[model samples]
Every structure is written in structure tokens, then in C-alpha cells.
Target: MNKSKIVVIGGGTGIPVLLDALRKENIDLTAVVTVADDGGSSGKIRNAVNIAPPGDLRNVLIAMSDMPQFYADILQYRFDETDGPLAGHPLGNLLIAAVSEKQGSISTAIRTLGRFFHISGNIYPSSDQALTLHAVFEDGTEVAGESSIGKHEGLISHVYLTDTDTGGAPIASQNVVNCIMDADMVVMGPGSLYTSILPNVVIPDINKALLETKAKVVYVCNIMTQRGETENFTDADHVRVLHEHLGKKVIDHVLVNIEQVPQDYMDNNAFDEYLVQVKHDFAGLKEQEVKVISNNFLRLVKGGAFHDGEAVAREIMGLSKRQAD
Candidate 1:
């Protein structure tokens, strides 16, 4: 009656939603979060303290924590502009930064915070050092920084990590690689393909481990297209990009949403960052030899579309069982 080992990789809001659901299941969960974020409270803190961005890690920690509602609220509390220099910064980000500085590494700080919050799952930053996400546009122009990649108007040619001379590329810690290699199942995305998910996998060691792992790798496709990142990307197109980057047939299953989004439910002006619903591409998926699990995995909240975490988790559990069988 051993629990299955599941390693979820990615960053941003989508990942936390998935983790929130996964935490309720009987599994050994480990969240390997991206550290390429250089915007908002995370960016400010990282620049000032020279540490990995902790915003994604904080969200993932809270999602898997067994703490009371009040504690979660306190960690996520944000200050207003009236608060001066600390304006718009979440309390958790500052705390993580302080702990990272004190402990001499983000990995240690994350573990300390996890213990403090009584997290149900393990959390690891993709890298110990701060990594910058650099992208080359289709026109050969290049943009540096995860926050700035979306601002470019051209299609992204490819993205790679900079700011390190270690083989001239950013690298993942050995601990992160070992977790992936040992997992029974590895889940990727439900987040921004380029910024959130790919930033973690593109690390040479991680990419190599993904190819070597015996785990059932599952990719949860986004329900909608992101304006700057994946403007018109289809479900299959998403998988294709991943395959191209990882340079192998690592993905075993792709969980996609087939439920149609209501035309008017999405307020473009309010959610201007999101462009359109991600088009279904079963044919393309078939061509890629990826087993497609399509279902009504949509949950609408406040005029925006999101993955139904419980539904997605159920599918993941089924996949794990099937793999075991």
C-alpha cells in the first residue's frame, strides 16, 4: 500500500491550483518550481537580495501546506502602495528572501519554510542560483528576462537560460534531477508553456533526466491561449513544442480540456492577457503518438477559465494506476 511518488514541475498560478488538488490525494508529492520569475514582488526581492524568486515556491508551499486558513492568509497578504517601499510585496516573498539570505541558499530557505508551514509535500527550487530566461524572437532579435519575453511582438524562436558560465547555461541542482529520476509520475504544466514550465525542463541535466526517467510523464495543456506566450497554440502544438525542447518522446499522456468555453464568459478587457481558448488538436496529438485524455476539465470563476484541479487530479491518479498495472 505504498503511495505513488509524483513530481509536479512548473511555476505560476496554474501549478498551485493543480497542487492544491493533488495534495488531497494519497501520494508522495514533490513540487519543483521555476525560479526564472523576475517580476513583481519576486523580482524586486531577487534583485535586492540576489536570491532565486520565491513567489512560485510560496504559492506551491501554501497549496500543499496543512496550515490553518489564517496562516495561509497571513503568508499571502500583500501591502498597498501606501506602505512605501514594501508596497505590493507579499509577506511570504519577503520572508523567503530573508530566510534565503540567512541560510545562504534558496533550497535551504524553502525547506525551512516548508517545515514552518507543515507542508504535506516536498518543494524544491529548480536551481539554487537566480536564473534568467533569455528568448530569441523569430526575427533573430533577442530578449532577456522572463518578464520581458512576453512583451516582444514576434513569435519566439527558442528560449535558453543565461547568467551562468557553468557550460555557459543555467543548471538545475543535483537534488532536483534525482527527484525526477525517482518519481513514479512526472506532471508538467497547466502553466505558461515558455515561462513557467519550459524554464525548468530546459536545464540540460533536467532534460536529460526526463529522457531517462521510467516515470509516466503527463502534460496538462492550458485551457486558454496566452497573449504573448502562446497566442494561437493548439493542444498538439503545445505538446510539439515540449517534445522539440526536451528532444525526446518523454511525454506519455496529455490531459486536455474538451469543454467549450462560453463565448461571452471571457471578458477580454479584464483578462486581456489571455487571448483565446486553446483549440483542440486530436489529430495532431495522434500524430505525435501521445495518448490524449480529453474531458470537461474547465472551471469558470469570475469571468476567467481555469482547470478543474480535482478533475485533473483524478485523471492523473488513473494514469498512475494504469502505469502501475
Candidate 2:
């Protein structure tokens, strides 16, 4: 009997939520996190150090680890404004930077920290080196950084990756391609479509694996449309963009949230990206020739809308079972 291997690809808060739930399940779970982040503490760290951005990985590691709340709190602690030069950085990010400097690679740093965190699932960055995301808007204009891309208000035609320091083409991190090809299933998204999810698949080697892998590729669609990214996009539009990138309808299943967010429930002040609920087009989805797993997967907290991690994980687990059986 062979255990099912599931590889999830993406970053940001959404992927971590799914991972947090998947960590408790019995299977071979691994995360392929995006390294195209260049904002906030991650940007500060990337500019100062040569390591891959640690912010996403920090959130990911904490979510998937067996660490107690107390230790997780310690790692998540942020320096207040009173702390000169250290303000806005998490303790975990600093720790990752320190270890990466000693080991000469962020991949090594992730492995070392994974053991300390007592993580059951493996975590791998999409690329070994830091990545810069460049977006081409509908007007043929180009924006150079991931931080800036989110701020630029235009329909993004496409996004591509490059090495942060040397401006060379980006490659998949070691073992990332192998993990994808050998997996029983691959999950993508429920995160920022352009910045978090696309950053990983847009890498050449990763794209090839997705195209060639026998694994059932599933896309967990985001509940809310994000401004400056998937604003005004339907569930089908999201699928179309992904298919356009991969050159075919590579996604086998797409999980859509049929549940509606309560009226005026979103706190746009804190999360400006929560622009509107994503519209659905089942006919459009059918045109893509992929299975749609529609359900009431909404989970709200303090006026913020999110996916029910355990619910989504259960659905994925069921799919894996069906595949294995």
C-alpha cells in the first residue's frame, strides 16, 4: 500500500490556512511556497540579505508545525516602532535570515527550522534565490517589483519571474520539480492569484512539471476578488488565466465557493484587497473542460472572509482517496 503524496503550491495567508489543516491529516504533504514577495518585512529583509524572502515561509512553517501557541507567539512577535531599525520585522524572519547566512542558502535554512519547529510536512520555496515579479499590464506597460505590481492599478496581462539580485531567469528550487512530478495530487491557490499563486507556476521548470505530472491538479479558488489583481474576476476568469499560462486546461478540478459573504461583512479598512465577491460562471467553467467542486466553503472572522481550512482539506483528502481507490 502506497501512501498518497500531496503537493500544494502557493503562498500568502491562504496557503498557510490550508497547510495548517493538512498538517493534521495522514499523508505525505509538502508546500511549494512562492519566493516572489517583495513587500513589508520581506522586502526589507530581501534588500538587506541575499536569502529568499522568509515572510511567507515563516507563516507557513508556523501553521504547519506542532509548536505550541506560546512558542508560535514568540516566533510571530513583531518589533514595535520603538525599536529602531528592527521595527516591523517578525522574530522568525530574523532567525531565518541568520541561519541562511550561516548555511549559505534559504533552502537549508527552511530544512533546519522545519526540524526545530517539529513540522510533519515538508516546505520548499519555489525558487532557491530571491525572485522579482514583473507584471505586464494591458496597456503594454511594465512594473518591476512585486510590491509595486500590487500598487499599480491596471489589468495585468501576465507576470514573469527573474532573479532578484542578478536579473536572470528564475528556476524552480531543488526538489520542487521532482516533488510535483512524483506526487499523487497537486493543489494550487485560494490565495492572491497574481502575486502568490502565479509566482510559483510561472517558473519554467515548475510549469513543465505541472504539464507533465500524472498528479491530479486541483485549484482552490479564492472566495473574494482582490483589488489590483483579480478584481471583478469570475471563478471562470481565474481558471482561464491559469490555463492561458500553462498553454492548456491543465487544472483538473477547481473548488469554488458557492457561499455568499454576509452583506457589508468585510472590513475593507484592514484588508483593502477584499474588494468584492468573485462572480461565478459554471458555463464558462464547463468550457474549460475541468471538474468544478462547488460548495459553501466560507469562513469569516472579525469581518474578514476566508476558506474553512479543514473543510477544504477534507475535500482534497476525499479526492485523493478516490484517486487511490
Candidate 3:
């Protein structure tokens, strides 16, 4: 019997948490990470070297590595401003950028590092080239760059890649499309909706592969609404936006947190980017024809609310089993 093949799509802190848990499972795992980031040390490196942002990819790689924790820590270590040329950059990001330059592509570099780190699963960038996320606001104003989108006060009408002059439709690598098409289950999100997850799916080939694939599509909704991105958004609103972009109800299951967050547990100073808990909309989710898997998926740690990765992984494994049966 073959192990179940699961493909997870997203970037940022959330996906890495989930990946860390899933790596222990007896399954074939593939991670499709977004490369549209242009912030912090990643932004600086991208501007300086014209490479895809390595921040998220670096985290994902570390999560999947079976190497010693000390090595992972070394890779994640950051240099302060006092470090001169290396200041503000994490060691992992710099290594990935260096390998990408040497290998001549981000995808090749990721594979090379995956072997070096003995990563448990595959990691592929959604695109090989650098991508800029461009959003059009409700007032018809436009904002360019993934880092800049959240700062706008107005509601976002929609977002697209600015890589092309024709339609701004970004392209995904064949490996990315093939992973989605071949997986037994494809998991989306647990990350920023617009910037993290959407950037990967908005690519025409990827969206089409998702619609065409027979794999069970599961969306892991965020535990909290993002301040500048998804303030006051309900569970259904998250699914709705995904469907609106895909042009159909492609989501088969939505894993949502049913547990209530403790009122004072959240420290705004620590989690300044998070706004409030995402409201539940069971009826609305049903209206969209998505099977809702609501559970106590909350994990509160260090004054921040997050998904319990093990619990979520169990549910995902169950879904994969049912799909196989």
C-alpha cells in the first residue's frame, strides 16, 4: 500500500507550525510556498539581489528538516545591525538566497537545501521568479508590494501579481501544478488569506489544476482575523473569498476552531498584527456547500492564539483516509 500524498499550500508562521506536526505522520508531504513576500530582511535581499523572498521558504524548510535542533537554530539565527553587511538577515534566508544564486533558480536551490538538511518532505516555490502582489482598493486606488498591502485603510477589491503587463496573472512552475493535481488531499491556508495563500492559488495554472484535481480540498481557516488584512472576517467570509477567486465551490472541507479564546489571553503588544477571533458562520458555510469540521483546534501559547497542529493533522489524516477509501 502506498502512503497518502498530501500537499499543503500557504506561507508564513502558520503553515510551518502545521508542517512541523504533519512531518511526523506516515504520509507523503509536499509544501507549495508563496514567494511574493517583500518585507523585512527578505525585502532587502530581494531588492539587492533580484531573488524570490526567502523568509517563508526558509521557515518551511526548517520545519521539514530532520536535522538536529541546534542546526535549525543556527539556520534561523539573525544578525543585528551591529553585524554590518549581514545585519537584519536570518542565516537561513541568506543561505537560501546564496544557493538560489549559485543554482540559478529558487526551485533548484530549495531542492538542494532539502537534501542537505534531510528534509522530510518536498518544498517547492509557487513560482521561480520574484513576484509582486498588487491590490486594488475599494476606492479604485492601487497598492503594490505584499508588505504595503496591509497598510492601506480601505477595503481591498482584489489582488493580483504585477509580474505581467497583460493580465497580471502570475505563473506557477509545472512541479507546483503537478503536486496539486496528484495529491490525495490538498490543504490551503492557516496563513494570511490575501498575501500568503492567495498568492499561490491566483496563478492560472494552479487554480485550474485545483479545480480539475480529484483530491479533497481542505481549507484551514485562521484562528484570528488579521488587523489590516481580514479585520472582522467570519469563517464563511474566508471561504467565500477563496471561491470567488476560483470561480466555484472548490473547497470540500473547512477546518475551523470552535473553542473560544480567553478574553485577556491575547496580548496586543505581542500579537499586534492580529485583530480579534474569527467569528463562526455555520449557516453561511453550509450555504457554500462546504463540509465544516469545527473543533477545539485552538492552541494558546505565549499570549498568542494558534491552531493545535497535532489536532489539525489528525483531522487532515482522517480526511485523507476517507478519500482513499
Candidate 4:
């Protein structure tokens, strides 16, 4: 069977897990990652080097890399010297920083590294520029950075790019458009509602392509709600926010988790949990004309909630087959 071309739009931790699972199947995958991250090692590099953030890109790359001997750990390696100028930084991010300087473009740097790592899939930033996200709180306070908005304690009124019409990696935009034009399926989310997922769709040209694409648009709803990001978001709330960003008619399918989590887990991570224990409203999705596919998406662990990569891969593969039929 010929591989189905798939374009997955998202960023950060969730994207890599999804990409890792999807790459294991016989499919062509393109990950369009967000560049608005101004936190952790990615933020440091972006602040110092004035280039696209590499943390998200690096995570996606490692996720899509061939396993057993790949640079997954190396890419995620953080300096712990605790006393040096270069301490507390991730090596992969720094490598990207170095490459961006030498190559003079993030796209060039990542492309060069992609070949080096023997990555089977493509990873791209939603934009090539180092951009900040701007949002106003419902309480009338304005927030400028993604990290700051995340830490704020109010609902967001609306969100947009800081430099309207400025800072996009044209190559990434073109890549996303091409992927959409050629894809059998284009999937978004299952990541952070505001930060990881919406950043890609908010881009003008990218959203236009999404609207115009002939591909089936599927939105994977987050398994948890994020504090400050989607404080009161339900499965319906997540889809609504997406439609608010991409228009109502743009999304075709919504993938949601049906497995119920323990209340203890919910209470413990209440401040940090993105997906609460609230029962998802199926009627809400039906009202939006969005088809919902429910499955067991939760993975219980020692310290965090995670999507079962293998299970997610199986689900996506099944969805692809259904689309083919």
C-alpha cells in the first residue's frame, strides 16, 4: 500500500509523542511546530541567538528519529554544571543555535541536522522567526510572552502574534501549505489548547491553507486541561477554541479520550493538569457537526499524564483507513 501523506500541526512535548508513534507506521509525516516558545532552554537560546526556538523542533526531531541508537537522549541532554555560563541548557538547542549562526537560517540548520540524524519524517517550525505571543486577559491585563501567559491567573480574552504580519519562516509556511495540499489527512492538537496548538493555526497564510485544503481536518483534543491556558476547557471547550481560531467549518473530526482517570490524580495535578476528570460532552461535539472518535488515551505514570503512543498510532492508522474507504 502506498503511504498516506499526513501533516500533524502542534508543538512541544505532546507533538513528539504523537510523531514518534505515527512515524512507526507506513506514512509520510510532517510536523509543523510552533516557534512562540519562550521558556526553558528554547527561550534562552532564542533570547541570546535571535533565531527560532529549537526546543520544540528538537523534541519533534527526536520523536521521529529511528530508534535503538538515535540521539534522543543526547538532544534532550541538559547541562547541570550549576556554575558555568553554559549551564542549564540543552545541547540540541545549543547545536541548533550554532547551526543557525553558521547557516544563517533556522530552516537551513534544521534541514542540515535532519539529514545528519537520518530522520524519516520532516520537522518544521510554524514560523522561521523568533516571535512572541501576545494576549489580553479577561481581567484587562495584557501578557506578552507564552511563558508569562501560562503563569497568569485569568482567562484570555484573545490572542495574536506580537509583530502582526512579521516573522514567519517562509520555508515552513510553504512546507505546511504543500503538506496540506498533498495530504490525505491533516491533524491538529491533542496538545496545549492555546500555546502548542493554536500558534500554528493563528498564522494568516497557514490558516488560509487549512481552510482551503481538500484534506480531512482532524483535531485531537487534549487529554487534560492546562491551568491558565485552558482552565475551564472541556472536550467541547477545546474544539470551540479551535473553531474560534480556524473557523467552524474547517475542522472535520475530533478525537477525544474516553478513559476516566482517578480523582486522586486529578486533585494532585489540579494546578498542573490540563485534562480534568469532567465527563466529556458528546452532544456538544455533535452540535458542532464534528465527528468524535473516543478511545483510551490515558497512560498512568509515576509523575505525569501521557498519551499512549502506540494506542494513538493505532487510532490514527484506523482513522486513515476509514478515510481511505
Candidate 5:
């Protein structure tokens, strides 16, 4: 079977999980990861060295890794036990930082890792800029950075890049454009709305490339609501936000999970995890002219309804093939 090229756009935990599923399908995957993370070891490294965020890219690479049982563990290993400077940092984050220094750019470093780990698919940053995310609240308040906005407890009215004119890592942007142009389908989201998904769309060249691409655009909606960013967002609310950001005509389909989440799972983590319950709103999505593919997409993760990456990937493959037919 000829491998169909796919461009998956997202960041953080979601991308890695999605890639893991897609890689097993033997598809030619190209991940366009957001670079707006401003917390954890990624933030520490980027701020100190004036470099773009590497955490998302690192996660993507692990998702596509051929030897995940080996290199994946090494890459994700975190230091602890001592109060040293590197105590809280993940080994993967540090390695990526070193690679960035040695190779002179994040893209170059990722390409090297891709080769070293024999990653099943290619991964690229959405932009080269060390960009920051700013969210405008319904009350006209603005919050900058992922960490700050997560705790804002306000409705995110709009989101945009702080500086769209700032140059991106040329290699990453080129790869993203090329993937979009060549792909049979482009997958967006199943990640954070403001920081992960919007950050990528706000990149000037990336958005232009997406608009120009002829590929079928599929938005894999998130399973649960986010507190400050997407407080009351239904499935339709998710689609509307993207349409408002990227325009209505850009998206072709929306994949939503219709299966109900287990009550006990939510009960355990509701308070500690700051998790928000997301209910299916089929009528709302249908109103926007988006054909919704409803499925069971929730996985029990530490007592919560998080996206089941493998299930999502299987649906994506099935839908793409059905479209092709």
C-alpha cells in the first residue's frame, strides 16, 4: 500500500500520543508543533538562551521514534533527588537544548534527532520565532504565556501571536509548508486551544500555507474543557473558535467524541487536576456546517477522560481512506 502523507498540527502531550497511533498505520506523518510553551524546563532553557521552545518538538519526536523503548526513555528522563541546578529538568529537554546550540537552529537539531532515533515520521516547529501567546478575555483583559492564562479563570475571547513579523526557523516553516502542500489530509488539535492550536495558526506563513493547501482539514476536538481558556466551550464552540481564527471555509470536517465519560474517573481527579467536563454538542457543531464524526474517543487516564490517541488515529485513517474512495 502506498503511504498517504499526513500533516498533524498540535503540541505537548497530544501530538506525541497522536503520532504514536499514526506511526503504527505506516502513514507518512509530518508533525507541525507549536512553540509557545512558557513553562517547565522548556521555559527555563528558552528564556536563558534566547531559543525557541523545544518541549513540544521533543514530545513529537518521541511519538514518532522507532526505538521508543530505548531512546524514548532516555530522552524523557528527568533529574531529581538533589537540589542542583538541573534537578527538575528532563534529559530530553536538555539534549534538545544542546542540539540547538550545536546545530545553530532547532530544525537542524530535530532533523539530527530524527535520524538518530529513526523516527517513523518527520516533525517540525510551527514557527522559528520564540513567540509568546496572548489571550484576550471577554472583559478586554489580556494574558500572556501558557502558564499564566491556564489559571486566569476568564473567557478567552481571542488569541494571536505577539509578533507575526518575527522570522521563523526557516527549515521548520519550509517543512510545514511542504507537508501541507503535499499531504492528502491535515489534522489539527486534540491539544490546548490557546497555547497549542492557536499559536500555530497565528504564524503568518504557516496560516498562509494552510489556506493554500488543498488537503482535507480535520479538527480532532478536545475531550474536556479547559478552565481559563475554554471554560464553557462545547464541541461547536471549539469549531467556531478555530473558524474565527482561521476562517470558516478552511475546515472540512470535525471529529467529536460522543461517548459519555465514566463518573468515577471524573470524581477522582476533578479537584486536583483542575479538569473541566466537556459534553457533546452535536447540534451546535452541525449548525456550523461541519460534518461531525462521532466516536468513542475517551481513555481512562489516572481517573479522567483524556483523548484516546490510538482510537483517534484509527478514525483518522478510516476517514481519510473513506474520503479517498
Candidate 6:
């Protein structure tokens, strides 16, 4: 018997949460993170080093690693904004950038770190080059850059990517296609639909592999709608958008949160990106013929909503175990 190989896809803070929990499962875990980040610390390094942004990669590595907490803290440490030459940059990002230059690609840098840091499983960037996300809004408007897409006020119609250095079509990072193709299951989301998860699947080779792979594709829907990306969207709408982009219904299962958030818990000042809770659409989901695993997957803390990663991980691994059996 072999360990079930599962590939978790997406980026941002959400993927790391799931990765942390999924690492505990008795299965083979691999994180296929998006490279289309151009925001804050990631943006700075992507510009300076002309490589895939390392912010998401850094978080994923930390989540997968069993290193001492003190070592993790040192890698995650940030210099004070008042300090010169090192302000706002995480030590992990610098380490990745240095290793990327030495190793010649972000994929190799991640591989090197994963082995040396004792990561539980694999972490691969979705692409080798730094990618810029471009969005076309419903109002006949276009925006470039991942950070700008969220800040720009308009209903996004679709999003795409281009190479940061040469403006060429984006290609799958080394091992990403093979991982997806070989997986027993592929997981998507709990991250930004447009700027994070979609960026990876929208890549030409990645998309092709997804279409050809026999693995079960599960979408972990967000608990809350994002202001700029998914405002006023129903749970089924999320799947619809993904289906539209992928040219057919590819996602096999969706994990939706059914529990309602208690009133007065959300602090808008701290977590401004999240808006109202996502509405349910069981009929719509049924119409798409996708399995809906609705549950009380919400974890409300410090005035914001998040998925209970352990709970979701349990569901995911349960499915994997059944398939293996």
C-alpha cells in the first residue's frame, strides 16, 4: 500500500492554514502555491530580485517545516520600519531570494529549503518567473498587478497572467504539472479566488494537466466574501467562475461553511478584506452536479472568519483514505 498523494493548490494566508493542518495526516502532501503575488513584502522582493514572489512560499515552508519555533521566528522576523536597509522585509524572504539566485529558480530554492528545513512535504511555486496578474472587470475595465486588482473598484470579469520579465506566456514551474497529474487528489482554495488560486490553474500547462488528470478536484470555498474580488457572490458562484475559466465543470467537490458568524465579532479595521458571509446555493451547486460537503467549518477569532483547518483536513484525508481503500 502507498500513502495517498494529495496536492493542495492556492496561496495567500489561507493555503498555509490548511497546509499546517494537513501535514498531520498520514498521507503525502504537496503544496502548489501561486506565483502571482505583487503585494507588500512580496512585491518589493519580486521587483528587486526579478523572481517569483517569496512571501507565499515563505509561509508555506514555515507551515510544512518541523523546525524549532525559535528558528521559525527568526526566519519570520521583520526589522522595524524605522530601521534602514532591512525594514519591512522578513528574514525568510531574504533567505529565499539569496537561495533563488544561488540555485537559479524559485522551485529549486523551495526544494532546497524543504529538504534542509525538514519540511513535511513538497512546496512548489506555480511558475518559475515572477507573474503579474491582470484583471478585466465587468465594466469594461482592465487592471494589471495582483495588488492593484484588489484595490481597484470594479466587478472583475476574468483574470490572466504574463511573465514579469519578458511578458511571455506563463509556464508551469518544474514538478508542478507532474505533481498534479500524479496526485490521488487535488485541492483548491480557501484563498483568494482571483489573485491566488485562479492564478495557478489559469496557467496554460497547469490547466491542461488538471483537465487530463484523473484525481478528484476539491474546492474549499471561503467563509467570507472579499470586497474587491467576490462581493455579493453565492457559494455556487465561486464554482461557476472557476468552471467558466476552465472551459468545463472540472471541480468534483466543494467544501462550504454552513455555520453563521455571531454578530459583532468582525472588526472591520483589522480584517478589511473580508466582507459579508457567503450565501448558500444548494440548488445551484446541485445543478452543476458537484458534491457539496457543507459543515460548520467556520473559525471565528479576533473579529474575523476562517476555516477550521483541522476539520477540513479531516474531510480531505477521509476522502483520500476511502479512495485508497
Candidate 3: count the clashes: 0
The local distance difference test score of each candidate is 0.91, 0.92, 0.91, 0.79, 0.80, 0.91
Which residue runs does candidate 4 get wrong by more than 4 Å?
67-70, 164-172, 266-275
Cα RMSD for predicted model 4: 2.4
For candidate 5, lDDT tens digit of each residue in 43-124?
A: 8888877678788888888888878477678888888849588977889888888988888888888999889888887888
Shift in Å, residue 170, candidate 2: 0.4
Best by lDDT: 2
lDDT by residue (tens digit), candidate 4, 192-225? 8788888788887788888888889888887777
The list of candidate 2 runs beyond 4 A from truth reads none
TM-score of 5: 0.93
TM of each candidate vs. truth: 0.97, 0.99, 0.97, 0.93, 0.93, 0.98
Which has the higher lDDT value, candidate number 3 or candidate number 4? Answer: 3
List pairs with backbone clashes in candidate 5: 128-168, 128-169
Give the worst 10-residue stretch by lDDT in candidate 1. 162-171
Relative to the true structure, candidate 2 reaches a TM of 0.99
Residue-wise C-alpha lDDT for candidate 2, range 174-197, written one tens digit per residue: 699999999999999779999999
- Model 6, residue 35: C-alpha shift (Å): 0.8
lDDT of 3 by residue, 1-325 (tens): 8999999999999899899999999999999999889999998988887788999999999999898999999999999989988998999999999999998998999999999999998999998878889888889999999999999897777887855323365778899999889999999978999999999988889989999998899999999999778888999999998998888899999999999999988989999999899999999999999999989999999999999999999999988888888
Writing each residue's lDDT as its tens digit, candidate 6 over 1-325 gives 6889999999999988899999987888999999888887889999988889999999999999988999999999997898787789999999999999999988889999999999998999999889989999999899999998989898899989999899989988759999999999999978989988999989999999899999999999988999899999999999999988887898999999999998878999999998999999999999777999988898987888999999899899888887878
Candidates 2 and 3, the one with greater TM-score: 2
* Weakest lDDT window of 10 consecutive positions for candidate 5: 163-172
Query: Could you tally the backbone clashes for each prediction?
Result: 0, 0, 0, 6, 2, 0
Candidate 5 residue spans exceeding 4 A from truth? 163-172, 267-274
